[model samples]
Target: MASSKDAYRRKINQNSDLGVMRHQVVSLSFIATPFWRKNGIGQRSPATCRFPKVLGTTKGVKRGLVLPLVATSSQEARSGVNASELPNRGADRLREAVTAREAAFLAVEQSLMQNATTSDVEGTNASTDSKMSRDSPNASHLSQKFLLSYLALWSEARKPSRAEYALAKIISFNAVRQRMLFDYVLQTNVLREREAMDSVPRRIKSDNLRLSVSQRALLHTALAQYAFMERVPVHTIVFSTVELAKTYYGQRFASFVNAILRNLARYGEKWMPELERRRPAEYIVRPLPFPEDNLNVRYSYPGVFVAKVANQLMNQERVVAFLEAGNLTPQIFFRIPCQFTDTAELRAALEIGLLVPWDGSRLSESAARPWNIYRVDLNCADVDGAGDLVIAANTDRVEWAHALPDTSAKDLFQKLLQKFIVQNVTQAEHIYDLCEQLRARWNQRRRLERVLDLCTAPGGKLTAVFEYLQKSGLGDLLTEYVGVDLNGQRLQMVHENIHKAPGMSKGRVFVGIGRGESFVEYQSGFVVQNADDRSIVPSFDLVIADVPCTNSGVLNRRPEARWRLSERDFATAIPRLISLQTSLLTRALRLSRHAVFYMTCSILEAEGSGLVRSVLEQFPEFELSWERLTYTDTAGRDGGYAALLWRHQEN
Candidate 1:
């Protein structure tokens, strides 16, 4: 397994340096036609882009290069067109360029396939990155922006403009988010001609205009643009994608690229049913139940998830809202210490024009939200709260993350009043609520100070947990606070976050690396071991288990989680995930002296309510006192599940 740091570096190379081109892929660039014409390369063909007389047909290749003259919605009539004519070129040069580019394409095709398959499998926190996607966890915790940055670098375009980066980010996320639907569309219209789902994608003779996984990814990118970004011109989508194939793969692919994308436009776009930007994502995702093609693509989720929805929520409109919410861009929200009172100042610093209602207001939290958290809108969310941005007395700050970008006075809020963690309103609200509940008990039992924040990444919820506890007057009560995570580097962050807070005696507040199920309570502190301990270990007064899940509820924020997940595959994956969730909760109970906190960032019943019932059934001594499930809302908050479990029979 790649270390999280190594994985983090690999993702960096993919997006920034393309240093991993040898192992993954190398992209090449083709200047767009309009940009070329504007630069005095007017109308003459840029070295023979037409088909060879030897190929015997020009199915997709045209006399002109493929690019679009973009027009706004107001000028709807000029939305799209094919490439413009280019100058004829020497035959020898055409053939040579064709062979070299085609060969490059062939080399990277397999790597592209393998990389796409791994999109949802692993993650590591990419705190050092400065992109919008950095704050939101990348798939495997890096590279939600990986592929597009990857394409740009391999193509030797070097640094992309912020606009290019933003476009790539949106396309990359949409491709992953709606991969199933895109694949479904391609499979039905084009891929069925060759795709072999049971095994590796077999290559066809190059003469037949074969579709490689590289081409499939390109098509997916194009499709994502047409479906999600309303302003993108269809002809431009064609040109960009076809040029991608022509420049990187060779001219051999440009025609096929041209043909497939036009077909894509025909089916779900410009010429077909005419998908509208405001319409729900399900508009073009319809396939009949008889084909086993349920609305999984419409919802961009697994069939097992769709079935679980029917069993759990059981309401049509609510389900639609839930699905639609995950497809919209999630907002950037932060948690303020309950102690802060400078709302007017904070708002002035972070605001542009209108201040929307609190996220709590959506949850009917009109009172608690205004004081607990205030939403800050910035075009960039990856601002590291360094220097003047610090919001605390002794450098304690909340670090929150968001993947998408927003529009605002990017300069005015470049620095903020408080260094707070990037958090969802609903999530922060729930955590605050949980701490308040713990407050009553802590008031009675002053000795309940030992705390274990289990399975959290570095600085995750640990900082928030401390602040919430402080507000409840329980901050000074802690003698031992141990934050445990699977990643050592992230745990180091936990140490950095908690080590500075008021209660610091050596070894009293620290972090341990390894699974919570095997973490051992050591003398005055904690240590994480890979296996069972032979020696006795003490228990924590409260164990907060923010266990991992499928990230179903947060698909908008965690798009990578959706890939590698399918209706058929979820049957296997969900069970394994439930097993892990079960193990973490079961172990947390054993490790706790008083109560165990079980939480997941998932809306699936199998992982949320259902799995909890199953796990608790085995332990008759524990009872669920309270649990809250916040569904993903169109208002931009990520969904989460949090529950408090009490041990009735004392140890």
Candidate 2:
């Protein structure tokens, strides 16, 4: 029997397809195991378990023998075994082992498939749950990470400052206006597309999908570039986004971000046509079918505000033009000092255009007049100082007093003017004109012994008052000038601006830190009495209360203001602003001996006319002498409301 087995083993080993037999033996081990026997196969002995090892080995062949052995001689035949029959039995066992192995493999594959299916369903459920409760602790961490990572400078505690706006614009490719729109698309459109492709629901809120700060910022920039900016190439946008992600996030996150942006680039444009077709009447997409509705989205003006403006203007065409005008950056107008030499040369070099003189004679014809025809008269200076000079070339849009040309000339002119004429740059608005008019009118009545400028930070009105005093030949008569502001930084700015004037001495101008509401009265030309302590301060013949209000009129100059101002914001702000304005005006009335000029940069009736009406009703002693409300839509300058109030004193 041993000889017969040896002969069979030698025959198998000698065959080139022994490797195939070894594979069969290895697979049969799975069926021979006790675990398999418990399931279906019959229980085998320990000798049978060693069969696979025996087949695998080259040196030793002795092991559990499953094959039925046959003898070659007559003596072996009597035992029902033959050498030739043994080979056939071996072949039969090998075939049986292969069949058993295949059954085991099929069972394993089915079990694995079932387990995977169960796990996938569970994962899907968990993902759905995560999306539903996106404000979970984990999601909060993600939200915070998203905000901090992209917009490091932004915080919920404070509003975005000018410096922050500037920084955001630089990183986000000047897409500051489209920030909210971009976010809207990302949360609603982009996120939806991603969710459709992926089975795993993104951990995103249905209403407000929270992305990492970097992710949000990058998405906004990319979308803005892809949708609006045709000049910017797709690859450049992708590269910039990837680089930004890598800089803030790790390489792994960068790869993840890269995949998302690439997907956007591929499929983003296809949706444009559909979006346009499905766009709501109020909402506007690019390549506008209706130009009338475009300003609401294109200029980023709130729909409510746009409707309000349309109602106020009473003309949809005018409303569109006004909104369009507001989107443009206003021209920087400079007031040439009486003392600055080479006025003609500067005017010629700059190609400076003059503001239409406010004499009321050429009110209609001024819009048609050429730029060169308008003259700057230094000797007979009005509120605008002869005439205001636009630092850049004027545009053909005659609706604005000056629409600055978008050219290299504008850039070069701004640079030269800033370098050469440092402190002469003044915004040509109706408020400044009002300030100058107030100062001139008061000085004409009686020389100003002292002047008080309340809330006088950024110091434009105060500086104008000083310049007016100098130009009107009342510089000697003005003994002291006092500027008070609640903000310390603005008070410092007042001090700095005061120092710029050649005639203004250190002792002449005093910038103090105090709320306008606190200072109710003044005793002498050198003393002020508030709730705190009595301080030596200059009493005033004139008090200019340029109180803070909703900067609605100057929306054209301040692009971010449109987003910041809402109907709710105005509703809440107007009442508080009215209170503050009332308090400041009352205090100014108490302090001034001759006149008080109450001014606001708001076009709203509630902020200007309403506030003034309330004050007049409260104080019967004061009378309104002169009031002017310049509307930007009509006047082509920033709209403002100014009322000159004077007390009737017994002779």
Candidate 3:
């Protein structure tokens, strides 16, 4: 029998990594032990062996002897044992703590399902007695998120795939101990911990109480991870947990937690497996259709549905191309010696762009012709504090006018500003950082030139371009650092922010509120046809067209948009958008020696790469060059954009 087990293991290893289901075989071996001895040896061992009766197999193998007799090579067996020890220990502990909680949670889910099924099965005549979904103690602890997490963990555990384990670590509980802790949290309201069950509020008393062995184990694992992962504060963890619990289970979270924790404290080590035995079938069989690419990019995302949405926008193949091509989230490049070399400085400047001094009220109130100013605050709740600062020019001017720090805090603020800017600033700051990188690249190419930003309103990228030019010694070539936009208000912002050369502030940057694709009349053939058109007069030596896109890449900034978006809307809009791009690019190509056309969108295949492809195909005279950007810690979340540069040489 031992030799036979060894032979089976050898066959498994020889088959190849793709074929060897190591964990499955190990589980099967355990299940086969009793059958192996019972039928193969034709004898029953002493009652000392603690084994389940269901170990019998479909093949003629009996339960008692099959598993024990199967032998593995010593090295293989040792490796397996070593690999299993940590998880086993963690699982065992988790089971001990969360078994009861598991049972309670399972009971709640079962009752809910049963009640739902009964309601469905019996229709209007279904008894109200079985109609209550949250009528168990564990119902308070169970939420859609919690249940999904549990289902994910259990589904992963019963299979050989490590995908579940990876997901389990992110969204579900990993071991039995974590569940035990979670159970305790659900069952207790610390202030009223001693209250009798009957005295509990009617809402609390009627919550679900179902759970099982595996779920309890899962709870423990989650708890263990929560306890570690040093980045988040414990209070934040507790707050998040409570919030999550309430989102799903409602009023019963406290009491459910209390009961689970008490059990964990008492019998965590002893009764884990017994509790696991009662795990629900739903927990084990839940299916996951999560995209593999998203799995790597967005580990913190909690729901599979959300992952599905992300997958539709950015497929794995594109994500891989983006990664392999080394285009990622761009870095925040800053010029030194500026007092406000961060988001705060950028924020105040509004239209000046880069890390410069700013006066928000001035930019907002300025009545100049071509004002380049805008803000984007990423935090959903804090609308005012979020947003990027945009201007159409370079860094030196921005720093001189806006971010010039006061004498008092100059040294201290400068020393510690980088840390705060990187760590605590708003979402717009991240965008500003990326723009800065582009600014640096622009400076690298054109050493000393009075650059023109033709379509530079709401000027984060514009300001970055300006600053990069300034730092690269191009300020001397400032005959005309012109900024043009149709918005008079934004141009006014540009006027108010520019302090270049004192009197030359008015002379160096000719702020014009005008259209790029126009001949003084500000009317292109397409615009004349549309009638609902507005334009400002503009043509320059350098044109930057960061055209409007679907804006799907920055969903975190505008979550309200995710639900509102659809393929139909995109289909209808893309043609119009492309027309606008063509209009801008045509004018840009003819007007400027070199032109850059860029947009921020994760659905790069269509809106970005496709757009570039279309332009190159249509305009044979214009040459296109491409560069990929960078994003950090976004393995799972999508934010890769495409920048296409078209240098127009005389045809």
Candidate 4:
């Protein structure tokens, strides 16, 4: 609508507006423009146009350059000339700056796209180092791999699975022999590193953040592998860890992981003196500077558990010995089944030498002499030597002189003899002795009838009872054998074991899934009712109530329990455990017309003697016939407590 000069002026102003928009979008500090000076739109003196202090250094730009649309000064705004009067140089310079800014914006967008694509493929093997040798035989490659895989899966909290047991077996293989060593190394390092960070300087600590769950697991595995892989070079350990980090996580984490493992490999021996000791026994038995203060850290036991043990043992030295014994891998013992009388079959089944019987008389003069025999004195007071059972060593039990570690013998016996072996195979000697005493008491009474086992899952004691009835020539006299458990799964296991036991008919053995306290409630469908159904639920001659306890005495076999258990757990669990035990025992006493054997694997008086005393207080009609508190140190067996009670007979 206007003349050619006005139209030209409008076109120049529009182009300048676009140039300002491009500059803002690209976030550039300033763009040089000789066109502005040539047109006299801004300061003509180059010295007067400098970059503002807010924008960083302008090394690339010429002097007197200014950002588009940014005001130069109040005087310049008031004195500005019209665009129509300005020359074409100003528009030309603006167009050039716009083109440059647009190009830069494209470059930034392209860079962001590339980064997103790269992040998509982050965990791929692109950044992995090739230094890790998968075929290295010096390292326990399988064990390390298994450990890493397992920790990755379980480091985050979740319910335990059977896979843990399988992993334990693989890690503890004789070929590896790194289970305890590795566990100790990993746990100790994790605790120490976590505590050590608190002591770090605040300034340095800001940059040094806490290790993440995955990071902690990886670090623990690396340090553990380094400690036990004596045959592997230190560089190999470091290299493998770095490669693992880069491959699984990314390069960002690789350097941090590599540094931790390298430091441990280099300075661990001096910093942690325990690492220098290769044998678990060495570390276990060594006296600490302050035994009470260092008990948890040195022994890898819960502080409360250590305190309780130290208190019970009275002497500090004895406490140490007891703890050492618990950590030692136990020896294995196998009892010959009554069905297999052939010595050759027995020897083949056990895969160990057959010594002369408890009677010194040999099967034949040419029979193999015992390899080793020592007359060790028996230390317990309850077990008395009787007739030929008593040796000059004041021990009632005869010696079978072969010694083998449990691990070596576990698999063989488990594979061959588990199903068909005696009612009691690989059972603690003290348990067998207790059963024998129970059998002797029954023989004295000369009356064997119904038997009830409360808290019977996995059916060990029930099997022993069946075997006793058969051997004592009272199998036909026993009308019923009942086993009860609250857990249906465990009750099923008891049924399976009972089915496999010899001299036991399926009809004679009853496995019930019910709470021991209210066992009669579950028997409704089975026609076992109140006094109206007299024949269905008859009185039992014997009731064996082996109640649940903390199992503190069997820590040697259940090492994982040490970590899973805590002092607070004990405090919370003990009251409930005692309540359940009391209920079970009371029910057993109610059902038993003659006698009840109350038993527990716990060595704690609160669970054993104290519990029995409480029961006696509640029911004064029952008299404690005999009681025995067996110590692992004294009996040379797993610790347990048993009290036999008999009902006071009415006139």
Best by TM-score: 1
Q: What TM-score fits each model?
A: 0.67, 0.54, 0.36, 0.55
TM-score of 2: 0.54
Worst 10 contiguous positions by lDDT, candidate 1: 82-91
| Preferred candidate (TM-score higher): 3 or 4 | 4
lDDT tens readout by residue for model 2, 187-275: 33333233222222132322111232223444555564455433344565666556544443334334545655665555445445555
Residue 67 accuracy (lDDT) in model 4: 26
User: How do the residues 7-56 of candidate 4 rate in per-residue lDDT, one tens digit apiece?
Assistant: 54455457654323323232111121222221335443322433233122
Top-lDDT structure, candidate number: 1
Per-candidate Cα lDDT values, in order, are: 0.51, 0.44, 0.34, 0.43
| Residue runs of model 3 more than 4 Å from their true location after superposition | 1-333, 336-455, 458-478, 485-507, 512-538, 550-583, 590-603, 625-651
Clashing pairs in 2: 70-81, 70-82, 71-81, 71-82, 71-83, 72-83, 146-212, 146-213, 147-213, 150-214
- How far off is residue 216 in model 4, in Å? 3.6
User: Per-candidate RMSD vs. true structure?
Assistant: 14.9, 26.8, 22.2, 23.9
| Model 3: how far residue 535 lies from native, Å | 11
User: Ranking under TM-score, best-scoring first?
Assistant: 1, 4, 2, 3
Ranking by lDDT: 1, 2, 4, 3
